[model samples]
Target: MANKYKCINEFVVDSYDENEQVEENDFFIVEVGSIWELQDESYLSDVRLMDNEGRWLEIAQSHLVEDFVKLN
Candidate 1:
């Protein structure tokens, strides 16, 4: 089978008010420098970085808009 995963070019982490909070699977927008470069888009679920193990860490969000991505 062909590749089924691609990394997104953007991963942003936002904060709520002093009395609010963020939730899991929070909907957000992500832009990529090159969709072709990233062969896996699902990997960008939360767009966060992880530790040596399997976890989600915070990644800087991207603001670029130059391409579109499709399922392969």
Candidate 2:
């Protein structure tokens, strides 16, 4: 199993499409849900984060800028 992460800040996801002229990546917010960081053995790269909206983003861990909170 892998560790899960929740987006604390708004970030951009570069989602490619058939259109060659699109210059912007998709924007994601905290409400979108948590992102998951899978282990190295997984077929996907170790740095990829899985978004709650089902979008897989390949981003550096440092760029994520995440924080964890304790729950009661």
Candidate 3:
């Protein structure tokens, strides 16, 4: 399919707001698949969430970058 890549999964990075607008500096949990991309392998993302709009972002780190394997 020529548009196979275009069918990639999409997500709306929306921050938890009750009465006000949320900024990008605000932290949030990306709820999607069971597996999540951790920042520097510390179970977090360097970038944060913001606004009521869909600020969707995809995270992918190469395994060669660092050994983020959790030790038992």
lDDT of each: 0.34, 0.48, 0.32
Decreasing TM-score order of the candidates: 2, 3, 1
Looking at model 2, the pairs that clash are none
Error of 3 at 47 (Å): 23
Candidate 3 residue lDDT tens string, 1-72:
111111123343435345435555675553322232322222234322221344323333342123223212
Model 1 RMSD in angstroms: 10.0
Over 1-72, each residue of candidate 1 has an lDDT whose tens digit, in order, gives 432223445655453332335565554433343232222232334233322223333332342221223338
- lDDT for each residue of candidate 2 in 1-72, tens digit (9 for 90 to 100): 457666555555556344422337554443334555543542322365554456555555555545321122
Instruction: Point to the candidate with the largest lDDT.
Output: 2
How much is 43 displaced in model 2, in angstroms? Answer: 9.5
User: Number of backbone collisions per candidate, in order?
Assistant: 8, 0, 1
lDDT of 1 at 3: 27
Candidate 2 lands at a TM-score of 0.48
Please give the ranking of all candidate structures by lDDT, highest first, separated by commas.
Answer: 2, 1, 3
